[model samples]
Target: MDLSMMIEAVVVLSSGLRLTLTLTILALATGFVISVPLAFVRAFARPALSLSVLAYTYVFRGTPMLVQLFLVYYGLGQIEAVRTSIFWVVLRDPFWCALLTFSLNSAAHTTEILCRGLQSVPKGMTEAAATLGLKRFQIARLVTFPIALRISLPAYGNEVVSMIKGSSLASTVTLLEVTGMARQMVSTTFAPYEIFIVAGAIYLLLTSVVVKAIRFLERHLATDGSRRQRRGSRLAPALPDAGVTTP
Candidate 1:
């Protein structure tokens, strides 16, 4: 590989980093907000309400994201009703379409992950909270949601990584994100190998940072007793003997 060409590839690809990060962050943030309520419904609501959530998750999760992107970006404009609707102003833009599609897709997966986490919370814990005179909403807010979020963190971390990778699909919709920039460079440089390597490395670096952050968060959120024990263990050797008198 030519050193100059490789350096050029890095700089060019870096230009698209903002767009990639924007898409990923917006999608994950929106999806998470939407999923929280849907997840609660799926976990505890009667089948009448839960069945709709189930159907939504199944449709989005079962289908290809790329196809969803195309449908939103290309297919939506084709319908006269869609074209004439007030929403068309936003739908006509590729960025909005990609964002909408990615957000919905992320919401689907997140709902299921959160639902599982909520379901996994021990029934005894909720019963204990109830017996203490906590209201249903209070128990859910003070006891249940926090535990479920902690339990879901690892799986949710994976979803974050997946969203970062999946944002590359935005390239298909005319968005010049990192992968799109690489493709554009390859067209001119005729060096797909080098250009794509840089792109993949960038993605790997992003995901690694996310993984480390998630691990740090996991440690930070550990139970107070566990955190204290771990801290004590680390500090034990540094302390002078408790019973030893100074010379």
Candidate 2:
């Protein structure tokens, strides 16, 4: 491997880092907002609502993300109605189309992960909140969402990482993200190995930061209160059973 070539590749790829990060961040943020409502509907809504949510998630999750990107960027333009509609202006731009596709794809997966978290919330916790005169929405807002979000953090973190890597597909739409720039360099230099290695390293670094952040948040928001419980247990006295007879 040529050291100079690798270093040069890194610098060139770094230029596209801004676009890559923008795609990843925007996709994940939009997906997160959309997922929450979809998750809520999937978990607690009527059968029709649940089925609709399920179908949406099913189709998006089942399909390849690359196909989704193509469909949004190229497929949408082929429709007569789309070409004439107000959305045509937005869809005509490859960047917006890529963003829209990525957001929807990420939202589908995030919704399912969140639904799993919601389902994992202990039933007793919600019941106790109800007993305290809280309405359904209040209980869900105060109890369910917080706990479920913590439960979902690890999975959501993975989703964020996935989106970061997946954003490389934006190059197919002329987005010129890191992978895009790498490909451009490779075309000129005919050196795929060094260029790709640099691109992969950048992705690894981004994912590592995401994993550490998620771990920190998980530790900070731990709901088990295990440390406090252990301390109290050690300090408290153990009393004899009231019903036990004297030996």
Candidate 3:
């Protein structure tokens, strides 16, 4: 690409990047905070007890987020009741609609990931906690959720990264996010290739930042203590053995 065109592309794409990153972080944070309790209920409660959470996760995960966004932004606008509702003031804009869709999308996947994490925890640990005089709620709060989070973090990291990419869908709803900006630049300059390449690069750069931050977080929250203790216990000789090395 020519230098002038490249510079123009970067300027436009950078502007879009700011909005993309902001929405991505806001959506993911909201999803993560909400998903834990949803997951807990899904994991431990009876089917009847957890019906709402289950249905919520099922509906969100099953549907395309683009469809959900459109339904919220465009579909809702068609409804007189929705227009009359207090929420209409906010939903009249596409930004909040995109935010709601992205947040709910991540929440569904996060709930599933955390549910798997909860299942991975051994039943013996819960029993032990109970024997130690821990109440049901106390055991769940103090032990289950933390352990489940640690176990599911890697998967959750992937979900978060996916969320960053998914935020591109926001443009479909008329939001001036990265993809929208790229399309606008293409239409204006008739240089689709240059504008798209630059916009794609901006998205790549933003996604890379997310991945690096998650890696830093994973390291900071590493469960070395439990793993090391488990390994040590395994390596320790259960009974005297001539072949065993002394440490």
Error of 3 at 225 (Å): 2.4
- Model 2 lDDT, full chain set: 0.94
Model 3 over residues 1-247: C-alpha lDDT tens digits?
6768978888877888788888988998999889988898889888885897889899999998888888888898899998999999888878888998898899999999999999999999999999999999999999888888888988988997788889989888888888998888888889988788887787788778878887887887776766888999999978878798998
Better lDDT candidate (2, 3): 2
C-alpha lDDT (0 to 100) for residue 100 of candidate 3: 85
Estimate the TM-score for candidate 1: 0.90
Tell how far residue 138 is off in model 2, in angstroms: 1.3
Candidate 1: tens digits of C-alpha lDDT, residues 45-157: 99999999999999999999999999999999999999999999999999999999999999999999999999999999999999999999999999888889999999999
List ranges where model 3 is wrong by over 4 Å: 226-247
The candidate with the higher TM-score, 1 or 3, is: 1
Q: Write the per-residue lDDT of candidate 2 for residues 1-247, one digit (tens) a residue.
A: 9889999998999999999999899998999899998999999999999999999999999999999999898898889999999999999998899899999999999999999999999999999999999998898899999989988999989998899999999999988999999999999999999999999999999999999999988887774567878889999999989999896
Clashing pairs in 2: none
Return the TM-score for candidate 2, rounded to 2 decimals: 0.91
Top-down lDDT ranking: 1, 2, 3
- Point out the worst 10-residue segment of candidate 2 by lDDT: 219-228
The residue-level lDDT of candidate 1 at 121 comes to 96
